[model samples]
Target: MSRHLLLGVALLAALHSAYAGGKVLMLLQSEKNIDRFSSFTDALTAAGFTIEIKGYKDSSLKLREYGTWLYDDLVLFAPKAEGFGGSIDQQTILDFVDSGHNVLLGVNSDVSEAMRNLAAEFGVDLDDRGTKVYDHFHYAVKEDGKQDHTLIAATDLVDSPVMVGGPYKQPILFRGLAASVPSNSELATVVLSAPGTAYSHDPKKSMIEPPALMVGAAASLVTAVQARNNARMVVAGSVEMFSNDIFNSQVTVNGASTATANKDFCVTLTRWAFQDRGVLVASNLRHHLLGSEEQPWGYRVNDDVEFLVDVMEHEGGVAKPYKADDIQLEFIMLNPYVRVPLQHDGQGTFSLRFKVPDVYGVFKYFIDYSHRGYSYIKLTHQVPVRPFKHDEYERFLVCAYPYYASAASVMAAFFALGFFFLYHK
Candidate 1:
């Protein structure tokens, strides 16, 4: 009986895992060969995702059914499609992301205007329609002793482990257009940028212009955006990078040949875009007296208070304690009264003990944490801080002793005067 019960429990667990895996809607072009991305699709399948492949021009495609999103993620692989068919337009894509769903958008040299506008919304500026990124010095060498400068061997990856499971040992092979992300953009970040020798221009034309539209390291090959709502989007310059050929290709840099890291990078990029990694959630926010577990209705000025919160990061559908050294807590009114770093117990419980500010008013406990490649956590808890009661004031203030002495002298003088008057009478 025990064995049967265990089997039933295991079956239920399997069902739960299957359902928890998200559904993805991949929009591709009928002309583009889907089999080329088998490796990428297989990886997603291994990660327990259900993929629904549809042509971008499929008029029956519906992202929403009865005002509800039917898919957890969207993949745009049809760069040449002028516009999505049916109800899926640029605004539809934006609304999907605005609703906190993830997107992985890919574009090529033939990128369409609709795709460009979508990328623009995410702060990714793609090069002109016919322009392709060319790296004269970093082009992949063909067996015929010719180099196609458009096929760039990009090694300038963003220095973020949470973003691109990094420390890439080899260059990623890219063949497509280039994009430019604003250096000062807070929402968008460059995941892979063209090498210093690379530039974006018309590959069919000669060099008459000195500065290309996107020159050298400024030409971003891949970018990722983490929206304020924590919706993630990754824009790839070359959709071919996710193909099996690139995944299995070898690149010769200098005198040595090594396998391309496109497969690993693409997998990591998709995982991040889908929120399977670097997703943080903060909960159990609590603040109270230093030694008390129960929170008071309100705090008193100058009270030693402790604030605690549980921070967890989701990976492979499992929540684990989030580890970081920079999470901070702020006690705020109009401005921050106290801002201090939160210390974690290695078990996800972050705590900070601070004295409430002497200023008494309605104050809020605020936490605003934004990390590159990670979900943004913004939390605010409002609480009032009361001043001391009149009876709670100190009995004998040193500053008031002079006044007390003066009053005492006045009373003594009156009594002495009264005694003199009575004796004389």
Candidate 2:
């Protein structure tokens, strides 16, 4: 019986692992001959994830029948598909993203309206003046002095260790043709851009006039969006950037040739988009008055209070301290009563000290810390301030001592007169 019970428990554990729901579903296009899905899947699986690739042309499978949440992540490699099958439309994809799932959408040189509208939802304009990107100044010069505009290289990556990787000893270079424009919509931020030497134009046609958009002023070749709910999306103009051909290609820019695989960039970017990196969390947030073990229900005026926050990076199956420079705090009561900058004292502790305001009533000590590339930390401690009690008021004043003396003298005179009249009568 004991052996049977152990066996049953082991089987249950296996079933739980199988249905863990953290798997990634890659939706690939049938028309495209790209087989790089296995490479990306392998990387994610090696990092302890279960990935499943599904081609849209498979008539036996239905996305709507798979239920609301078949996977935790979705990768759209089906840019050329005019539309999706099995209840997977624009609204379905948007709802999937809005439900806190990660998405990696790739746009080819020939993009469709569905992909364009989806990119627009994230504030990225794939149609920049209705032309492909071609750089004259940063193009690769052929042996005969002709510029090659198709296989351009970019080495300027965002210097964020969390988004890219820790202390990137080597830079990532990309060789492909992709163009993007900046997003003017709210809550969208650009991540990477081309150098000033690059510009966008039609490859098939000749340039009659100067290009309308330049490199620096243009949006970004590769952009990432972090939604309000912490759901992430990485949109790239080139799907071949993740292929083994480009991943193993060498890039030479401005006489400096470097042989580096695009795999590093792809892996780091995918990890970031899939919520494996750049995740900040606040764990233990505490506040109290000075010299007290118990958090006070109320505070007196000018009371010294100390606030501490334990910030951490929740990634890689470990919760570790997050040491960063851009975190801030605010102590607010009606408006911002005190704006204090928390200083990390070389430990996991972020703390600050300030005297309580002189105003009396219910007030809150607030810490509103929001930084780019990190999760926001908001904490509030509701503390009531009490006015002075009856005995707490000033007992003896110099100006009021004469009034006290006069009242005492009158009382004494009345007592003496009453005693004398009674004895004489």
Global lDDT scores for all candidate models: 0.88, 0.68
lDDT of 2: 0.68
On TM-score, the leading prediction is 1
lDDT of 1 by residue, 168-238 (tens): 88889999988988778999998999999888887577878755458888888999999999899999999
Off by over 4 Å in 2: 1-21, 31-34, 57-68, 128-130, 140-147, 166-186, 217-219, 255-257, 394-425
The digit string of per-residue lDDT tens for model 2 on 68-182 reads: 6776788887777778766577787788788877888876767777787888887677754245555555544333455566555655677676776644433344333344555
- What 10-residue stretch in candidate 2 is worst by lDDT? 168-177
Error of 2 at 279 (Å): 0.9
Clash totals, every prediction = 0, 1
TM-score against native, each model: 0.92, 0.80
